[model samples]
Target: MRAVIQRARDAKVTVQGEVVGEIRDGFVILLGVTHDDTIEDAEYLANKIVHLRVFEDENEKMNLSLKDVGGDILSISQFTLYGDTRKGRRPNFMQAARPEQANTLYEQFNNLIKNEGINIATGEFGAMMDVTLTNVGPVTLILDSKEK
Candidate 1:
């Protein structure tokens, strides 16, 4: 499992011109699941994201976690994150998990966040989505379950 976590002032996902999910002062998490991903991977990434200290403190220091700032999360499934472009002009997604497995892990990840007592919004899994966000400080971080 992997996630691109971006701090945003607000974020929303739209599908077929209908808003599917939205959030304010939170994170826009683009998540990807690999063939090797399991529930443990989902849980680890979710916990890391929620506790990441990317938010600023009262003294203007980047010292506050999302939980400390009372923020929400907007999770979006993005299998393309596994696209391997090293070989040729075209990217390959062989490392990405099958839709069935990916969707299950994605749902579990969202549930993990929600179980943390924070509001969590999500884009439709496997749907074409248009995501919009006002990135706060343009703060972005990438987390991969394989790393730790």
Candidate 2:
């Protein structure tokens, strides 16, 4: 499992001109699942993300977690995060999990986040979406379950 976590002032996902998910002052999480990803990976990421201190404190230091700032989350399943360009020009998605597997884990991940008592919005699992966000502090992090 992998994720590109971005701090945002606000974020939204639209499918065919219809808003699917939206959030304010929180994270826009681009999540990806690989063939070997499991529920434990999803749970680990959810916990890590919740505890991450990326927001600023009264001292202007990055000391506040998502919970501390009362932020919402917009999670989007993005299999393309595993697009491998190591070979030819065309990107290969061989490392990405099948749609069914990916969707299952993705939902599990969202559930874990919600269980943590934080509000979470989500994009359509397998739809073409247009996501827009106002990035805050331009803070971003790439997280991989294997790394932990």
TM-scores of all models?
0.98, 0.99
Instruction: State which candidate has the highest lDDT.
Output: 2
lDDT per residue, candidate 2, 5-104, as tens digits?
A: 9999999999999999999999999999999999999999999999999999999999999999999999999999999999999999999999999999
Which stretches of candidate 2 lie above 4 Å from their native place? none
lDDT of 1 by residue, 16-109 (tens): 9999999999999999999999999998998999899999998999999999999999999999999999998999999999999999999999
Best by TM-score: 2
Q: Rate the local accuracy (lDDT) of all candidates.
A: 0.95, 0.98
Q: Weakest 10 consecutive residues, lDDT, candidate 2? A: 64-73
Residue 79 in model 1: lDDT: 98
RMSD of each: 0.6, 0.5
Q: Candidate 1, 81: how far from true, in Å?
A: 0.6
